[model samples]
Target: MNNNPFCLPVFTDKWIKHFNTSGQEKRFDFIENVSFVKKSFLPVYINVGKNLTKGISYKFSNTGKDFKKKVFLLYDVPDYFELDTTHNFSSLKTIDIQQYPGYLVGTSQYPDITAFKKSRFGKSSLAKVNKYKRKLESSFDITYTLYYGDISRETYDLVFDKFKELLEKRFSEIHVHNNNLDPDEWEFYYDVIYDMILQKKASIYVIYDGDKPIAGSINYHFDKVAIGAIMAYDIDYSKFYLGFTIIHKLLEWAIDNGLEIFDFSKGKFGYKTQWSDQEYYFSYHILYDSSSLLANLLSSIMSLYFRLKVNLRERNIGMLKNKLLFFFKKKKKRATKDYKISEFDDTIDSQKFSKVSFDVKTLEYLKRITYDFLYSRSEHIRDIEIFQDLNDKKTFVILGKSAKQKVTFE
Candidate 1:
């Protein structure tokens, strides 16, 4: 056991049972390490072997309400550490800390893989996926394989090398070359994946075209949750849509293994929403021991700094949005007139379809269908118009600089 008084030892089944006997839905708190800290010793023993003056600082994602309340019970002024960081704060009650937003893709929303593929949206998505599979198969022999529960070291090393090569090549295509990603840079992931593999707590899925790996995903499993950590596909097979194909296979595997949650971990990706049922944020908290005046003062100062940082970010939201737009290579100017989605009907002119604005509901719906289309890329898009056909049916027209496409709502 660790000698640090600030750390809590790993709990056994007895402790878990005691805490979960309330008959409520059980929640598993995700942690990167086993050394734990209670709020009581946070001020003095926080730095552990380092220095007491530095205090303790920890970051947690997907923190349970029970755990948050426990921290609140231990701290004197719990609100002091709470950071106002989330846009969806209204969903959660007034807690001692703010939750930083994060994304999760889980199997809880769907009963089974079959049911998941049976929805209208699911059917449409799968149809496109199948089409891609057929197109890819015409060129090479395709196979999807998963490594979990006793993967040999030889297999682990081989797959890890291939994943690295594929990732580097893919990034190179986008002009995002990372020359520093040598063996040393990858050692951390290699060690973590290897350990998890030995314990049968990780899954690595790879899609191959003949003997060559085309795409791969690394996932860690813990207490019924599978977290997807790394994913990369060969740029050569990108046109075949292998990236999406590999994740679909991983989800199918998760269902087969009875995993409850399939967390994408972190990021703001458009594709994640396709398989996600809900979204929540992640927050970092640092609680100082109240008895120590110096620790309390430092902690209070740090909290104020974080709060001000968030406020400054909010004021300059436009700059951040523009940066995101540029990263996606999208146009920055708006071209259409603003109109509430509900107000769109046959009375609207088709000429106005070149540029159109939507209400929140329509904007969200468009995002789901287009997969963050506007935010990612609006180049060559002359106009986006919505109107009703002669039969009073909703129709969307995408008028490009030299091309046109029409979408009819069912």
Candidate 2:
């Protein structure tokens, strides 16, 4: 909690500067709530991370005695903290409640990553992870690289571009807006990460397919913990479970690097829950002077509002929010024919096959399955061949050393 990357020096001036540029004054500390207390001129100190994705590390002064006059708002606080008790809010009122469920791996608790993972999933799961890694390695000319402390600017630019592309593409396919792609947010990441990398406070872990960075993860390192901040993978290689593969590589790297915790931050994603050894919750804390009736009422009201909001999000209201999001913000996707696996085999065909120039664009729809085929067969990308059937133009054949695969689509 103390080493929260968002609260660290890595983003010290950058985050608040980004905050200011977004028309949020940095001196709004005395304002209780922007949306609620804006007109009331109430004294409040809102301490939170960027967009509340992280809980800002705050030092208590005088055990809550100093800030009794101000209504303090802090959210996305980890459950491991007993701030209300430790702060001794005897003269003040503090309301803390669970917000988002968090998942993380207590890596220091284990001898190595293998032990850490086995503690979460059984021994068989390790085999499954190995199988996936093998599939990915066999599928493409892939290399796992961790760029930390020292990385060429050109390579950083190349990989970061691909990282943004992957995140944008993945989110676009699902019609969800990727906040990481936001111009201001992306700018901060692009600028801050390079400096942080040099300072050994951040890292970019990349899964490269030959010269291409197909999947990438950005992690912030603080003290002994590494926060799994942003991660995205090429959907084309998703059939090989690149998501699982990447996390395994990351965890492996983490263990080797002597990291203690691999915090998956705030999300309650299935993969995080599946791999993590610990389950916790981000809490929302409302601190206000109990002596003041108005501050107490405001704190209670804000607590009720946030508690209800988080509760609703934890329920069907969250699904409805997504639906609403899609309805309002969904982009007009391109009109593409329904993708179907199309393959033609010269061996099985009565008609002759031709090796005429195949449109690379046509393979766009077939990329995933083709990659998957390479994975299962352990075939190198160059070793595989494609053909068109003379009788049926829609049918395509994928010829490998051991066998041939076919796909047909209208």
lDDT scores in order: 0.49, 0.71
**TM-score, every prediction:** 0.53, 0.86
Q: Name the runs in model 1 displaced over 4 angstroms.
A: 1-33, 36-100, 118-126, 177-185, 305-410
RMSD of each: 17.1, 4.1
lDDT of 2: 0.71
Alpha-carbon error at 290 in model 1, in Å?
Answer: 2.6
How would you encode candidate 2's per-residue C-alpha lDDT over 1-410 as one tens digit per residue? Answer: 56555655566556555654443433332222222112236776555343534544444444225455667776676775444344445656678777788888877777777687677776787788778888777767888889889999999999888888778667767766566676888987887888888888889999888888888788888788787778989887876888898888888888887888888888778898888888888887786888887788788888889879887886868767654665577545433455465443348444567663333765566666667778767887877776677888776677777866886767
List ranges where model 2 is wrong by over 4 Å. Answer: 1-3, 21-41, 63-68, 81-90, 334-359
Candidate 1: which pairs clash?
43-289, 100-281, 100-282, 100-283, 101-281, 102-281, 336-355, 353-385, 354-383, 354-384
- Candidate No. with top lDDT: 2
Model 2 residue pairs with clashes = 30-44, 341-407, 342-407, 342-408, 343-396, 343-406, 343-407, 344-396, 344-397
Instruction: Give the CA lDDT, 0 to 100, for residue 293 in model 2.
Output: 77
